[model samples]
Target chain A: MNAHDLIKEAIAEKGKFDSVYWIACGGSMIDLIPAHELLQREATTFTSYIYTAREFDIMRPRRLGEKSLVIACSHSGNTPEVVEGCEIALAAGATVIAQTDNAGSKIDSGKWTTWVYPWGEGVPQAEVPAGISLSLAAELLDQQEGYVDLADMYAGIAEMDKILPPAREKVNAELGDRFAKLCQEHEFFYILGSGPNFSQTYGFAICSLMEMQWQHCSYIHSAEYFHGPFEATQDGVFYFLQMGSSECRAMDERALAFLKTHTDTLMVLDAKEYGMEAVPASVRAYLDPVLFYAMNCELRAARGKVFDHDPDFRRYMGVVEY
Target chain B: MNAHDLIKEAIAEKGKFDSVYWIACGGSMIDLIPAHELLQREATTFTSYIYTAREFDIMRPRRLGEKSLVIACSHSGNTPEVVEGCEIALAAGATVIAQTDNAGSKIDSGKWTTWVYPWGEGVPQAEVPAGISLSLAAELLDQQEGYVDLADMYAGIAEMDKILPPAREKVNAELGDRFAKLCQEHEFFYILGSGPNFSQTYGFAICSLMEMQWQHCSYIHSAEYFHGPFEATQDGVFYFLQMGSSECRAMDERALAFLKTHTDTLMVLDAKEYGMEAVPASVRAYLDPVLFYAMNCELRAARGKVFDHDPDFRRYMGVVEY
Candidate 1:
């Protein structure tokens, strides 16, 4: 059985949980954002908290308990802190579910009560973890409060896989050339998103721009944009608007209007603008980050045009021992 | 009375809570990080959730109830979302404590059942909200599980207000001259911190550099630094390590070690290096953010020497409609 089936089975045997401790590290930590927002927005039966692995180990919020369902993610499967988080959850009598890119690596050892690997392998412009993240959100919400009786969220996954590639090519063609030039010219950029797209805003800013090309950027949520980050607005400061159909769309629209007057440097990629005719309206918002990630691949390629920098280029990352 | 005494009185009347909802916006939102971390580490009786005011207003987690204490903060006390967050918590039958700098602003206009302004009004290099944040943490921890007495926390704050001015002058004389040259030289910087200091790192990045001079910076938490930001480290990448005495110190030390090998552009300001002659050892870690904030005064002043940009220098902030 897959992740959805496994979770359903776990709930059946281990019983319903009172809370959830969503813990992971780095890019893997970003995977928890959508499911968390969904549960926070929809589910009332259970409460959820997302923590960085070391934060979990050190702080140990009292919310984690026997009735807590801990979802731990690590793409590499060898991240030390993530492995430690899994161990900590297990010791606290919480059920541990590990999501990893590698099936038999360190995180996939006997410690995890159940494990899941990447989905949608080799699909153009797709993030396997993001696909799983959306499906997991749908399934959990479906089971919660009987909102919808989804057989599992695999149907939503099938819909996404079918429609996303065509949309990816179209978005790439439309926005890729323009964004690449902006990337070459601008010294600073702020990627903004809200709700479900929050983690993706952070991921694209750090993982794609800073990590991939050594650019300077920050990920600011649209809802909080007016508070502090909006102060950074000037003619030279660029804003990458990652638009989605989440509940916070109104907030994004508000921020965009404000940005238009202060700075002309804006690159918007609204999933609502894309052609995902096959995916239902019910689940489209939950997958916007996946759609945005697909669009980002082209932008990454565009940066490849101006500079000969590799995403793996680093003096200290994997090269030095500390 | 001060914030601690105010909370104690409110707790006496409203009764103790089993959970905490920490709500605020921007700088005020960052102020809650230290208290949240301390409570998460020490208190097993009360669970805590830190949310941006708008997030708390929108999400309305199922856990919030009559048995919950909601701490809402804003400096101006006129931020719309903060007012709405307090309204939401009040409607949920939760006790609300408003922390604001303004005495009679909208957030202070007959809305909050309890409120607090700064204690030491004219102290040099002191953040009123941060001092309150530490005191709140101590009170919450003391009330939960009968942990260590926290009268020492107040004594530390008094020491900080007294000895910090002289130390600030010293640091300004020693590091200020040198750091100003670096600030003038480098265009990009990554301010890294963890646990209690993480919020201040972000505050210094957004409030000081980005807002004050439109300089580029990203505040990376030590736990999340290794994930993506670590990839940005090379010969020219600058890192400002705002070291505080917290449980996450080891993680920050590890990152600092790796950064030393990779980049020549590294700036470290550890609280341990500063002298607080009167502060007791038991509560010094809780007040490290306060120490760092004091040191930041010199850093902010150093930026003043290199350029003339006001914190209020903006094209859109408070000058136009959104």
Candidate 2:
């Protein structure tokens, strides 16, 4: 059976996987957060725990055992912490699922899984990094939400595929120049979100700005605005709010109302405002992160051209004995 | 019973607490992290969760119920989020343990237990807000490690009290002037820590600087250094590393090694490096945050003088509407 079928079969099986442990770090951890949040909303019988890859390596959570299902990911297929986690989970007699950018890399020794995205015709289908997270979420949801929900999600994905081009074109043509112009003008940025969209808020702040553009940015939760982080807010401060139609939307609305009063440079990327016509209302909340990613790329695309630095190149990633 | 004995009795009662829910925010949340971490380390039967106070108010975890013990704190006893969290957790039938500087504060209502620090008797006996967290931790540990272990911690606390005078005197006499000289040198500062000390590291960064002193700072986890925040590290960048004992020490060591190699301005606050002779090995690991707080105050003492900012004054704390 294929990876999706295998995952569904595992979920369908009785008396298995009483607990789900997600072992991931950095980018992988960010991606898993949405699925983790969704699982909390949907799966009542499943006790879920998420640990940073190194913490998992060190703590070896007591509940992880024969009845546990460990889902770990590393796009590079050789992230040291993920590899160690997989090895330890396998040794503990827990079922292991590995997600990697390449199939034959170090992360492939466990239950094999891959996420393939369809490329244009005449070009081979591309296996994208971190795509497995989305597939993993959908497969798990297939058990609770039924195959029809999965079908609806796919239709939504296809619908997004159709409208994404024009959306990107419009975003680039209109907001791209504006983002590029305003990007450097702000010394620091704070990105805020709640619910599943929180992952994008964090990913954009850390990945797109900190790691990619070497800019100063911090991600704050919408539920935490009145806390200490808001002390830094001022009239001219820039903030990007990734608002979605999740259960925690009220939290974001409250935060946005406060930020709008405090700062003039507030940008709200509402998933509802975007064209999501084909997405069923029942499953729309789950797609917020996916839609947020599409919107986040616009800022990334604009900043990539404006800045001289390449996001891929790192000074100390694999250099000099780290 | 005394507070310590009462807590121990609560823990000993059969099936009274199946889980622990820590409801806190910002500085309060940071103070609670060490206790939360220690609880996770010691409590095997207990399922524990730490949430920002507002998040706890909005999301209210399904696990929080009659069988859960919710520990929530606010120094001033008037943080709106903590008040809401206390109300919600009490309404949900969870036992509430409230920590505050004042016993008569609003958080003491509705079947709530309180931890009140002595603020009188000339020069205040140094009402360290984080001290409440450590005491709370010791109370919980009283169940697992017994009263003898808690006694050892109290002895360590007394020992630190003896040396703390000299430490503070030296910090104020010698380092105070130097810090004042270099107060405005850096644009932004990063605070790093691991293990129990992580809480103090976060509290010092957010509470002492951002909220109180009106400065910019960010607290990054030591294990997360390589992920995104490390991209901003450079030759002249300053980072204060609150290295400590406990299980996660190795994680901080790795991050410190990298920071030392890259930056000449690395400040390492090692509890062992300082005069901690009176502190016993059995309880030394837990004193990391306590010791780190002492060292952090030196910086605060210095900065408060140089910047013409009182750490106690606020622009919009209880004085204004949210």
Candidate 3:
């Protein structure tokens, strides 16, 4: 079976339980933080974690009894931490669900329920796997009964490829000017979001970590912007507020009110203003933030005009070693 | 009433509650973060927060009911947020306990149990009201059974005073050299801690904000250190770890181990190594980290002896008004 079908079955089959722990390193666990945030609000113990293999071996949580689900996600399947975490979780009596890119990889040898994604046509095999793996794990934990329509998720994946080509060209045209101006400036950029978009707050830091390459960037909830930090919002501070649904709308309003209090640098990206060249609203603002963030982050990267040139793309954070 | 007696009475009265929500801003809140770390583990929902009066007016938790306690702390009893938060909590039916240094300040106007500290001789009366106020708050919170012993805490506080005189001299003496080396060499410094010290990790940022005074700084928990940024610990990096009890002990070990791995630029101040100087292990290594931090922060102001003649005392990131 294809990677997509395998993932769908695992999402459909996992029984409802008392606790859910999603374990993986970096993006594997990061993509699921929003899902866990939603799940935790439902009064269940839910956690999404990122750890190296050696650290995982020394500090694995106890109990994976009948009511527990341990979702081990690793796009490469060979990632040391994800494999070890899967092994440890299974030995502790927890039900393991492994999402891997390569079906034949050793990660498939674990006792957990396995899901695999194959390299799709024309799409780079590496990126598609992590995104697909995460989408599968999110589907299982999304908890909205009508939301399990796997076909819809698969269909939505096409939205990015169809629209991104034009957005890329449009951004590339203006990127050089923006990058020059940004490089000349001595200021800090602050990204603000609220509610479900709170998960996307991590996006700002990760983008800085992986792309724009600035350590002075920070992301805070929109409501928190009004606190003392607001006083620091001089012309030197660049503000980016996520203007999607989620509860971010209300926070967006508050943020707008705050911006009105001063004549400074506040950039608001209202997705509604962009019109629906994207997906449907039924996707929920919580989930939509990621899509909106991917677009927003892409724009930022294009404006910065920085991209990896290395053929082997060495991760700045290094290999996921134990 | 004497500070110790009033603190004991307040604790005896608050022992009936299962959870607490401590509220303050700036120095008042920074002091409480260390204590709340212990309280959070001992209770069901112990959460302490720092917020401005404006933010409190908006998203203050509604109808606290009888399930919690709100300890509104302000060294001066004049901080607008603490006074307003105390009033809001009282209105919401939660028991509000006010810890302050002034008996006639605005916070005293709230309908909550109050404990005030008398300004001591020689110490700048206005500079550290929150320190004494927090000591009182800690005593009250510890009165609730086997959490923390008040006598031991005071003894530890007293021991800290003795340890400070000599360490303070030594560090202050080296301030010029340290400042010159840091400013001339490093682009940034990352302050780290775990468990109890994690609560005060922000204190390092606050000090860097007040002193360093132009250098960029970031703080993170030790568990989070390994997640991504630890890889950056090359010869150019400067790291400071706050040594405290609880997970601080384990994190200290991990940090020391990490230092051995990447030797060039790591500087660790392990409390365990302090030996008899940091007496009364019952004192909870938590508070000791803060005491040492307060002194180390002085190095920021001494900056290569450049600012010795003209101190930049302007409040940059301190208390703000809407």
Interface Cα root-mean-square deviation for all models:
2.6, 2.4, 6.1
TM-score for candidate 1 = 0.89
Candidate 3 residue-wise lDDT, B226-316, digit = tens = 5544544555566766665433366557666775566466656555544324656644554655555555555554562554422234333
List model 2 lDDT by residue over A1-322, tens digit each: 2447657666655344656778777777876776665555444444566777887787666666777778887767778888898888878877777766665778876453433232232221112223345456666656644444666655554455555566567667767777766677875677888766777887787667776676776677787656666766777778888877655678788888888887888877766666654567655655667667666767776877887666666777666577
The local distance difference test score of each candidate is 0.73, 0.68, 0.53
Which of the predicted structures, 1 or 2, would earn the higher DockQ when compared with the native?
1
Which candidate leads the pack in TM-score?
1
Considering only N, C-alpha and C atoms within 3 Å, which residue pairs clash in candidate 3? A3-A116, A3-A117, A54-A322
Over A84-199, each residue of candidate 3 has an lDDT whose tens digit, in order, gives 77787777666777777788787888466777755443463224533454454445544423345345444545554554455445434544345435434633455667655655
TM-score of each: 0.89, 0.84, 0.66
Docking class of 2: acceptable
Model 2 Cα lDDT, one tens digit per residue, B22-102? 888777787677667656645445556677887677666666677778888887787778988888888888878888776
Instruction: Rank by TM-score, highest first.
Output: 1, 2, 3
Q: What fraction of the true interface does each of the listed models get right, in terms of native contacts kept? A: 0.58, 0.37, 0.04
Which residue pairs of candidate 2 clash?
none
Worst 10 residues of 2 chain B by lDDT: B120-129
Give me the candidate number with maximum lDDT: 1
- Which window of 10 residues has the lowest lDDT sum in candidate 3 chain A? A41-50
